[model samples]
Target: MGWIGETVDSIKSLQIRQVLTQTVSLGMIVTSALIIWKALMCITGSESPVVVVLSGSMEPGFKRGDILFLHMSTDPIRAGEIVVFNVDGREIPIVHRVIKVHERQDTGEVDVLTKGDNNYGDDRLLYAQGQLWLQRHHIMGRAVGFLPYVGWVTIIMTEKPIIKYILIGALGLLVVTSKE
Candidate 1:
């Protein structure tokens, strides 16, 4: 009986150590992800180097759940180029294609008008009140690349908090139970 009790105590101690190791490993994984995101931001010169498309307004070119890679550069924005921009009062950024570009001769500032491929009209109604065009400051980045449907995970995690928590719990459990 005494030997059995000692063995049980050792098992409990080993389980605790395994849990702690797994927790640290999970922390390291999250930290590495953050580091990679920051590196992409720096390299692309965009505040958001990657964004998940949340709307179908740009369908046929970009669809919902697509992951867009953005790049900010000094090159002039031209007509037909896709861009992401934030509205004055809107929290979500919008992705659309430039339909018109009006360059100011006096200040060299460019004013751009955008339209969604699936929409019949331009994006004037989406803009802020009394605003007609999107200035350079309003633009965040231009779409450089995209991965189709890859962002569905992000959308699912965002829309279903319980599923996200369950996934995290399951991953932690797997790590804690996994034997070397």
Candidate 2:
């Protein structure tokens, strides 16, 4: 009986140690990810260095599952450049090509008009009611490059809430079950 009790105690102690190690490791991983994200933010000069295409609005040039890399700088935006911008009352950012750029004569502020390659018309219909153009304030970043079909996972997770939960759960389980 004494030996059995000692064995059980040892098992409990080992389990506690395992759990603590996993928790600490997960915390470290999360911290490392945050640090890397901050580094990317600083290096790219963009709030979001990377973005997943949420819609097929920019199709033919960019697909819905494409992963786009963005670079933001002080350089003047040029025509034919792909960019991401937010419209008033819209939560999601849009990816489009700059078709026209009009600089304010008084303030020198640049206003841009965008269009989708696959769409029939410009994005004015998608903009907020009565808003004619997108300002610099609404611009997120200019698209530098893209990886095809890399953002499908993100799109899938967004499309189905359960998939996100399941993926997170699996990652957690992997972290916990992994032997250090």
lDDT of 2 by residue, 19-127 (tens): 8988999999999999999999999999999999877888777888999999999988878999999898989899999999998789889989999988899999999
Over 116-179, each residue of candidate 1 has an lDDT whose tens digit, in order, gives 9999999999999999999999999999999999999999999999999999999877776676
User: Which numbered prediction scores highest in lDDT against the true structure?
Assistant: 1
Looking at model 1, the pairs that clash are none
Candidate 1: residue 64 Cα off by (Å): 1.1
TM-score of candidate 1 versus the correct structure, residues matched by position: 0.88
Cα lDDT, all candidates? 0.94, 0.90
The candidate scoring highest on TM-score is 1
**Which residue pairs clash in candidate 2?**
none
Q: After superposition, which runs of candidate 2 have C-alpha atoms over 4 Å from their true positions?
A: 1-16
